[model samples]
Target chain A: MLINVPETVVADALRGMAAAHPELTVDVENRVIIRRDAPVPGKVALVSGGGSGHEPLHGGFVGPGMLAAACPGEVFTSPVPDQMVRAAAAVDSGAGVLFVVKNYTGDVLNFDMAAELAEDEGIQVAKVLVEDDVAVTDSLYTAGRRGTGGTLFVEKIAGAAAEEGQPLERVEAIARQVAGASRSFGVALGACTTPAKGSPTFDLPAGELELGVGIHGEPGRERRPMMTSGEIAEAAVDAVLTDLEPRNPVLVLVNGMGATPLLELYGFNGEVQRVLAERGVAVARVLVGNYVTSLDMAGASVTLCQVDEELLRLWDAPVRTPALRWGM
Target chain B: MLINVPETVVADALRGMAAAHPELTVDVENRVIIRRDAPVPGKVALVSGGGSGHEPLHGGFVGPGMLAAACPGEVFTSPVPDQMVRAAAAVDSGAGVLFVVKNYTGDVLNFDMAAELAEDEGIQVAKVLVEDDVAVTDSLYTAGRRGTGGTLFVEKIAGAAAEEGQPLERVEAIARQVAGASRSFGVALGACTTPAKGSPTFDLPAGELELGVGIHGEPGRERRPMMTSGEIAEAAVDAVLTDLEPRNPVLVLVNGMGATPLLELYGFNGEVQRVLAERGVAVARVLVGNYVTSLDMAGASVTLCQVDEELLRLWDAPVRTPALRWGM
Candidate 1:
């Protein structure tokens, strides 16, 4: 097990992120990472959050032109409505706030409660649920598609639209558009060890694969024997393609599951590209790294988002968050 | 063992990086990642090389404000002079070129030979040897203080200066200055698996630690039982402080040795800052994460560079590379 965390794991780690990045304002009491200068006038503020183990996701993503604020839950646990209420209230401009909710039951419930909480206090709130994981139709903790890597696309594209001074409806529409257009599939070599559990969430015998695993270590469809990188890429890419066939000018992301080294991730990206090319899907823009991850789980996920000129422009817009930044 | 890389791992991964980042042009035969707009006329080009597994290091680091070209050797092996010579020739814009050679023996020797070869070919070359790891006066792989994370500082500060149109001599001098002023210390909780070996680099019994571990899995000073995060922070901080006491403002980097999740790193960063605050060393700036890493080794290193305003300015300068980017 590779968890070497301290007491108050989530609090301590959040504090560390605040210390490293002065641009992020940490509300220790509320447990949110806020943009130092929030409530950008007339801009639809974006707020996202989930379990904390996925570093740079909800928290590392809190910055200008991306998330106005991020509410982080404990490792692999859903954020409470209190955090969402406070984050939405704190970042809300005159324009309504938008919550980019991932499609997990707990997350959806909490975000829904928080949206109501904000509206009750005379604050307008909207949400665009991201449920892009095509791995399982339903999982242990999710009612439908489990939100995975495609959340990043929603966050980035919607964040850019909001930053461009779009109204609340326009930003929410962008989020919905991207959320519906993207699809992802993941394969895990092993399970992640949560701090609370002190052991792997599940066990996989040697040379066994946990195909289509969830970000929170939820069980996938099968326990197949180990497959070559080529086979794994083919399986994942085929799954994504079967769900939604992206034409030319696709954006591909081969993301690592924490413990996988960049070398392995890059190699996986090559295999992914090879499979996509063989399938006649052109990868116009590519991103390979650990954007979304299960803590210390050695595996990767492939995300393909069908993008036209507008989506590409929004995706390529300047993003200065801690995790994903470019074209600034 | 976390590694599941493709055949010819380094070559395949380098190709993946080339595909993802169009700004970078990879010379497959030479195994070098080159900046598309190399040899910025009248500016000193920077070249760095090392083993492949410490990725993004001499490779992910090649971009506009970083190395003009990076020569990657086989996993955990020093790059040969042939790769470095070709890189130097390709990136040299007639103002001349500088090499950021790590202190490892093979790396040093290869870079030295490349410098000579480049000079023979009517190209001027200068070198700044990074010897920042203070864990040992001599190591299994090096004759002197072995270079570690401080090489990144040299590369960035030097890269910014070069991009600002600094001449070869000035860029080389800045690199040398940064290299001299930085000190690093790393501890490993486990060993890495090389692709060629297909197993761990070494064995560390459960709960036993490898203090002052090298990036390439060399033995350290001791193999003691596991220590608390606080204690680990204390030992690493004390070692760096004893080596070079930062008077007021200092830059602290809590670098993770691959495999360690971002949560653990952030928690470690918190511990480090707590220790520093206790000792009253003002942290002017901080950077945490895996910049240089051993492939999937679960551990971290603390690097402290006593910085003045100039160094801080150089450090904060805009860098747009695959691995590190900000302030653009």
Candidate 2:
């Protein structure tokens, strides 16, 4: 509703980011946002990117303790290999770079090619794929499970590790560990329209919701009659708990998909807490709001990551990003 | 979409707030969210609130450098005088308490009553009215201009002043100054549905937009055919710039009304920046996101706060709220 035109949406948004945040170096022509303090000597640099609509995901996350750089593609489309390669080269110190790629076909293929190109340029590159959405094993844009809210977890924890001067191998391992320990489940109350499409991506009936919905409006497990927040929380928590089976305290993210207000998200988080308590799941920390999103879809997703002491400490470390910031 | 029922929505969200922010004491029964470190000795306490649907306005702003306490009412309803009185008593140290009231009739009346009641209890009280909306001189809920995005500026700058151990008189003066120096204008592409109504609050035809929309679906200046983001920005910035006509650098807030995505907000912000630059308004800071909001309304508001050195310093102070946090 607030765009000048479909064709210039990404560029316009990039210009806004550049203007809003002078702390970061935004390359509008190349579609990359990099922390001005990039190429920190002997620090592992974390780089991530994907489609543009899921804000505060990659671009807004570029700061002191998060991604060193991010490549933003058009809405619901993966960034090309050039953007990733340029980002890696721009931010890579002699210590190397870690690519935090979400699990989508186009993203995975492009990041793989970018990794090879960066390696050819004598810059060490490592990749960790986040496929934590437990909704479906495969989806329209993904060969395996899709990446959803857990991308925030992976980037944050691993970014802290990198900021602490962890070697590339250790940083990559931490990112992969976070991605492995997290699982996500989503529900869509209404479909979101892409700028290019200019219409709802999928038809959602008035009185029903999509259970286990994908972030990009992909089909979920099934469509069901609207459920109470408690019922939805029970279903969502059960889905993640069954797959994750956390043996330690967990970090929880009650994420809104673009259009859901914080009022609804907080209410949903209360119900989520109730369900987790009933199941005896110890929660180490809880974050509620729209961090990862699906454009303007009216929905929410829950991501759970089992956290040990080390992971918890890293999670609590200082982060200064546009979307997520705490501590110092 | 995530509520258990219309009646339990506010209470349920309070429970969620309790779960999410243990640093804030959430009194579910009293509908007051207070910072755990309230009533700091020799420091003036800042208190504010209004309707509940504006999630982060008062509730999410409760922390060290923003609001000491926030009294949340039902959706689009004024918080009762009792809530404000209790909040004042609970948070008032030896220094006193300041109430930041929006200019809505209900809010003004209730806060006035609250101030008297608190003063009767041996607690000193001060009040500042925020009437920054430039849409109209009067509205359905307000006699003067309706308060909008500028409430954030008042709460933030004044909160910072109070945090600096300012006296009640000085803090009140700062808040009133901020409220007076700010101007706001909003545009809504769609209306928001209340939980109780279970439907759109007002009918906004698909191709039309409401210029200068109020926070609670109140009638605006006029309705017009849908305009591009640039056109909307021009109109919104002009409305504010004409009224403000600032001679100094400004702090800009491109706030989303509930359901607008960050993508659109950023794109709109770019146009806002262009317009401001062309108008010779030197922007010292730009914050783009949903700060003040209606419930699930697809819209955006522009707020301009003329800031001098002191006000800008207060604006840049450390704020550790759930919604707005920076510096340390």
Candidate 3:
């Protein structure tokens, strides 16, 4: 079971986050984390949120040059509109606020309602829906692809563009472009047990694999007996490559599904890189770790984001976040 | 079961790390990773190593300021003296080299042998033996406390001191103080599967935990029924607090086992913060994530390092490494 009190997980986690990172402000009552330097005049504010189970995602992502504010809900649940509305209003400058919405129905509905409410209250709100998972056309959770690790690419690229003092429209375009060019595929070695339900989210027998699995333990393409890591990495890379079809260099993120070891992820990364190189794809940049994760799920997802010069420049730009930081 | 071929896991993982991070050099022939600019004259180079399964430890730590070189052995096995000898020689600027070693018998023995070999070759070598685990006075695999997450502290703090161009003796002294002042304790919810063994190193019942567990899955203080996250955090904090009679601010690291989720670790961190606050310990700096981990083990370790201005300054100094980087 996930190591937490089922009743007070989100609020408790937010407290520790505030203690560890003094650079951010945690409004525990409203359950929103905002960068201390938020609401910079004339600069577009980037906001992201979803379930709280995915740590270092929307909340840990809040800092200078990244997400201005993050609204965290309960585990694998969406934050309410009030939290989002407050975060947007607090971080919104004269320029505007961009909501980086992941493409889950709950998140979309809440964010949409919040955006409308914010605008009515005189806050300019724009939204970019992140739905870059190519693993399934439809899954157990939603009608289309469920948002996955590629949302990190959208956040980072969009955050960088905003850091450049770009207008809200320009940052939204960059975020949408990155999200559009990204594709992710994952494999689950085992199921993760949510704390509320102290059991595996799904059942997969020993030595079996769930190819193209969703982040929140949604069903995947098919179940097959476990294969060698080389074979598994090849499958994930092949799925992502088919969707990408990029002739240019790409940024590769080999994200762990919470429970997997860093070594295994890196081992998987070697095979993915080999396969990509053989397929004539140059991985100019790579991130190998858990950025987005399913809670304690044993598996990994590979996200390939096709990057042009501008996207690559933004990707390489300095960012200072609790989770992902570089060159700052 | 660990997602790779059992025979070539360490070497293959190293290949991926080298590719993902081009800032360091991989001496595949020697199974050692060295900084490209190693052997900088008059600089006190630092070296660290142990088993290979623990990623981002020795290898991921080898970069500009952290580790000058990291030798990798087979899974859960100590690196040979030859590997350590080569690493120390390679990174020994005229100022000499310091090896940050865990307190494991194998690691201590190998590093000791390597120090002799390096000294025989006219390259002075010093070492800091980390024995910071405060869970027990003795453990299954060790005569005294077993070095765990505190090794990362010794490495980081010493690396920073070395980066300041301190003499070898000064750097070693700094490492020793950090190591001696640190205390760690871990609890394992499940066992980890070693690649070569292809099975769990130990067994835990459905709702039991191995408290005060070692990173290698060695037997701990005792087995007990699984408790709530708040209970677990409290137990761990109490253990560490008894070991560290802190009268000043501290550096805290709530490290995750390989398979634990970042969210749960942060959840645990919250309880830890509450416990620490109740105890009146001021946490000056904090880090929460998977730094030192057992391969695929579902657990977490809490390390508390009593720090003064000097140690805090060294920790805050610019460090450029694959595993840990901030303000660089």
Residue B121, model 1, lDDT: 97
Among all windows of 10 consecutive residues in model 2 chain A, the one with the lowest summed lDDT is A190-199
The parts of candidate 1 lying over 4 Å away from their true place are A1-7, B1-7
Q: Write the per-residue lDDT of candidate 3 for residues B57-111, one digit (tens) a residue.
A: 8788887778999998888889999999999888887799999888888889999
Q: Which is superior by DockQ, 1 or 3?
A: 3
> How does the DockQ of candidate 1 come out?
0.56
List TM-score per model, in order: 0.98, 0.99, 0.98
Tens digits of per-residue lDDT for model 3 on A45-164? 998899877777988788776899999988888899999999999998878999999889899999999999999999999999989888898777677988988889988999999988
**TM-score of chain A as modeled in candidate 3:** 0.98
Chain A TM-score compared with the true chain A, each model in order = 0.97, 0.99, 0.98
Q: Evaluated with lDDT, which candidate comes out highest?
A: 2
- The CA lDDT at A102 in model 3 is 88
Please rank every candidate by DockQ, starting with the best. 2, 3, 1
Each prediction's interface RMSD?
Answer: 2.4, 0.7, 1.6
Q: Candidate 2 lDDT, tens digit per residue, A211-260?
A: 99999999999899999999999999999998989999999999999888
**Candidate number achieving the greatest DockQ relative to the actual structure:** 2
Q: Output candidate 3 Cα RMSD.
A: 1.3
Ten-residue region with minimum lDDT total, candidate 1 chain A: A1-10
lDDT of 2 by residue, B32-106 (tens): 999998888889999998988998899999999889999999999999999999999889997999999999999
- The number of clashing residue pairs in model 3 is 0
